[model samples]
Target: MYCSANGFPALVVLKMNGLEYLEDWTVEEGAMANLKHLKIRRCGNLKMIPEGFRHVTTLQELVLRLQPSEFFERVQENGLDWFKIKHARSIVTKR
Candidate 1:
């Protein structure tokens, strides 16, 4: 489960689902610089969103659905992973 490697950062929207093997999702450094929206759905085995999100400074909205409870809990406001995504303008979660 890997995306093609490239140097230019132009992606603006990303959606992923059903990636059981994807334990960690990382957008390459300096890549996805324009990414403004992201959605992750039904990825049961992806324990947590990748730590690299802090580098996606332009990310404005994030939506996560059908993820593990523990994973979701960790990303809750004031949770351990909250800081990584705190800069996102909007964060939504659905069970």
Candidate 2:
């Protein structure tokens, strides 16, 4: 949410986990323009990545680890979350 600030720059790599009560996470347009790698681990309360995630053309890798069942399923090849990040060169998911 705070990443919506204009001065916010895309992170080359981001790792997040253990954030309970997290939902409806969203990133603003062009917020992560330079992001290349992302990792989400042990976030059982999260539902899905932001819709803007798809627009991060610079994103090259995405890793999901030890997440909720829904989060895992939704990121599969044809799942809802898949469409947002299908362009990423690599996507790894773990239960």
Candidate 3:
């Protein structure tokens, strides 16, 4: 999914499922500006988190489940995609 700026401006929490074919998600700067919690499940094909997440300063928590181990690793502290979500206070991943 590709989200542009100002999309879902009032959104505080978002949950997505059945995205097995989704390879990536892009969030443009300022998109989901008010989002605090995000959950993505059943997205086994997703490769990585979008770089634009760094712009989502309001994001507080992220939860990823039922995804590939490599995908989950990318969100770890020393992982490649960590910078995208470092601002989030909590990140949870479950196989």
Query: Which has the greatest lDDT?
Result: 3
Report, for every candidate in turn, its global Cα lDDT versus the true structure: 0.80, 0.82, 0.90
With a 3 Å backbone cut-off (N, CA, C), the pairs that clash in candidate 1 are none
- For model 3, which pairs clash? none
> What digit string (tens of lDDT, one per residue) describes model 1 on residues 1-95?
43333433778898987877777665455667788998989888887766667777889999999998988998999887897788999999998
TM-score of each: 0.85, 0.89, 0.93
Q: Tens digits of per-residue lDDT for model 3 on 1-95?
A: 89998888999999988787899788899899999999989888888898888999999999998888998889889899999999999998898
Worst 10 residues of 1 by lDDT: 1-10
lDDT of 1: 0.80
Q: Give the per-residue lDDT of model 2 (tens digit) for 1-95.
A: 34673334746888887877676688777887788999998877888888888778788999999998888788888998888999999998878
Q: Supply candidate 1's per-residue lDDT for 47.
A: 71
Give all candidate RMSDs, comma-separated.
Answer: 2.2, 1.6, 1.0
How many clashing pairs does model 3 include? 0
After the best TM-score superposition of candidate 1, give how far the Cα of residue 95 lies from its true spot, in angstroms.
Answer: 1.0
